[model samples]
Target: MLVVDDNSNPFEMSCAIEIFGLARPELGRELYDFRLCAAEPETRMRDGFFTLTGVAGPEAAESADTLIVPNRPDTHVPRSQRVLDVIRRAHARGARLVGFCSGAFTLAEAGLLDGRRAACHWMWADAFRARFPRVRLEADVLFVDDGDILTASGSASALDLGLHLVRRDHGAEIANHVSRRLVFAAHRDGGQRQFVERPVPAVPDESLGPLLAWAQERLGEPLTVSGLAARAAVSPATLHRRFRNQLGTTPLAWLTGERVALACRLIERGEERLDVVAARSGLGTAANLRARLRRETGLSPSAYRKRFGAGPAQPTAAGGSGP
Candidate 1:
């Protein structure tokens, strides 16, 4: 992985370094051969915060399997032609590309995102659309994963997209490990809204943290929207509104997503019987598990297991063979 630094924002650049560049000794292996390269020998950071020096030159992007483009504070300023040319060449060579915040502008300027779906800071939604009418800009979502090209919306969402890329490349368990190290959520679906209308309610609302924890602990108990509402001492309608406002999703969608995640973890832990895994995860039947897992993970249960399963099945709590 190579970070193409051209007046990059420190937060987003640091996110890429933390997620992909840092060594994961706990996982007992290096995740990537990470490097930082710039078009100039000494590039100034965003807002003239500091000078970045001693990094590789633009040519280093040629050998990288993945290239992370720069996102600067001034979106109006055009990127250097040399940087754009490097991005175009990297894409042409089939290297994966990432854009954090206004970095989408860099990719679009290079003509790589002409017909691709992407995301950028919500504040720049109008400018991004007006300038690059050809690209499909999803300003509402935290990130857009359009195959080889991925773009993240705000500074923090860069971490979300980075974790997602980690999940895609190394699977759920490893991604969870990385998230744990960062003290962040293991997963936040790309479809979730990037901007919540009231990030903090004008009047303090009851936090759903305890309720969510309760639901997660009981994911295998055939949970439902109404049931969760009742548990939270609220009506179903109120629950739905709260979910939309606070979680950026409906209650049912959150429940389903949790169950699917539980199902994936089970598979990773060597669950072999689809029916048992489904029932334990509250997905009900093997068929339902298959559909949900594939929809969420882009891989069937067997395929996911083959890719992420730890080892042979161990004994179950009931003194029987593991699922």
Candidate 2:
């Protein structure tokens, strides 16, 4: 994988290098062969305070299986044709293309995202729309995975996409292991919103913080709106209003999401029996777990476990343990 650096954000660059470039021998497989690339003579990031040298040129990307554009020089500033040509050549040769944040601008400018479902930071939706009307932008998403092409909204979404690629190539187990190594969620669907906090009030603004924690530990128990509100010492409607204002989502939706997240962890830990996984994750029945997993991850219990399950933790659904 080659990460194309074009006078951009250091944080986004670090996000990629940390996930794809760093070695994780603990996973027992060589994952990505990540590298950095520069198409020109001037080698400084966007701020010009951080200087990058010894970066490989475009020719290096030609052989890589994947190519990434971390960000554009600026959404409004035009890129040199020479750089665009190199990026196009990389795509033409069958390398997977990735663009995150304003990097989508580079893809759009190159005409790659034209008519394709793509994403960029939501705040840039209007600018992106005005600049590249041909692109079918899904601005609300955390990222977009269009087979050969992948794009992310911004910030941690960059990590989500990198981990997503890891999951794509090596399966969920390896991705989860790498995610655990980096302390990140192994998967956050591209359809999820880019930001939840509207700002003047924080997510912690007397916002069901304790109730959420309480519900997390008791997902197996029946959780109701009234029960949750009672525990928080507020009326159900007040709880709903507060959740909407502070979390940007409802309590039930948040609870279900948390349950799905827990199921992911249980599955990743390689629990063999679907029923056991279902029981412990508090989704109850295997059928219910199946339904929820598909809704959340677009994968079945067996399939999700297969992609993400790890270690000699439990007996196989068909029969025996890994060891």
Candidate 3:
């Protein structure tokens, strides 16, 4: 695994370390050999008045099966040619290229993202589009898994992308096992919209935050638009209008999206019993979960599991973050 580190936030870098460096040998898996490659061979990072040293050089990516570009510090600025060259070499040699968060900028700079759909932090969506006009930028999503080229929004989305790569390499079962260990969801459909900032819709003085939090806590219980509205002490009409205005969706649609998100986590964690996955995700039935997964991701639960649920010994396409 090749991890290309830039002047990236250590928080994002830690996400990579957590996903790639940690090994699970109990299941007889050949875990990623993670390498931290620095463009200049050695660099210094400020970690709260402490200096962190970079030991690995760009050549660390030479033999990698998968290359991961972590988020860079600046989204609007162009990257160095040295960084571009490293990326080009990896791509030409058929290494899978992944950009997490602003790392998409580095990929775009290398011209690898030309004519391809890439995901970036939605906060920098406009700048990313303006800078890389040749690249098809999908601003409203968590990530994009387009075959060998994968890009993800920063923050928690990096974990989502890493788990996706795990699933792609090993299969869902292994990825789910990792998720269970990490207390995270294994497969979050990369298409969920990035939390973009928008003008708050004009609605009643009522707050949706509390209601949404309450709903999250009761995901296992039956939740309906009417039920939620009752809990929020609002009329059904007011609630629907408020949801549409504030969230850009009806209450029912929003609820379903939330449930599906939960279901995806449960499914990724090897909650193989469809009934259990459904109940946990609040979908209520195996059929419902199957239908929802299919509609959202074009894959049945079993098919998804089959493709991405294998144990973690499978060979990667190339260039992830370890030795």
Candidate 3: where are CA atoms >4 Å away? 24-31, 46-54, 74-78, 163-222, 235-291, 295-298, 307-323
Worst 10 residues of 3 by lDDT: 314-323
Question: lDDT of all predictions, in order shown?
Answer: 0.83, 0.74, 0.73
The estimated TM-scores of all candidates read 0.92, 0.79, 0.68
Q: Write the per-residue lDDT of candidate 2 for residues 1-323, one digit (tens) a residue.
A: 44445577887888878877776666555465667777764567877867787877666666666777648547788876766776787679766788878889988888888889898998899999998998999988789988788899988899988887776565555667888888876656676678765446443546566787689899878888899999988799988877765555678877776677777777787677878877877788889888988876678878877766674322111001000
- What clash count does candidate 2 reach? 1
List clash counts for every candidate, in order: 1, 1, 21
Error of 1 at 177 (Å): 1.5
TM-score computed on alpha carbons, candidate 3: 0.68
Q: What overall lDDT, based on C-alpha atoms, would model 1 receive against the true structure? A: 0.83
- The C-alpha stretches of model 1 lying farther than 4 A from their native spots are 199-205, 311-323
**Of 2 and 3, which scores higher on TM-score?**
2
Q: Best-fitting candidate, measured by TM-score?
A: 1
TM-score winner between 1 and 3, please give it.
1
Given candidate 3, what's the lDDT at residue 311?
42
115: Cα error in model 3, Å: 2.1
For model 1, name the residue pairs that clash. Answer: 272-323
Q: Which model scores highest in lDDT? A: 1
For model 3, what is the error of residue 52's alpha carbon versus the real structure, in angstroms, after optimal superposition?
5.0
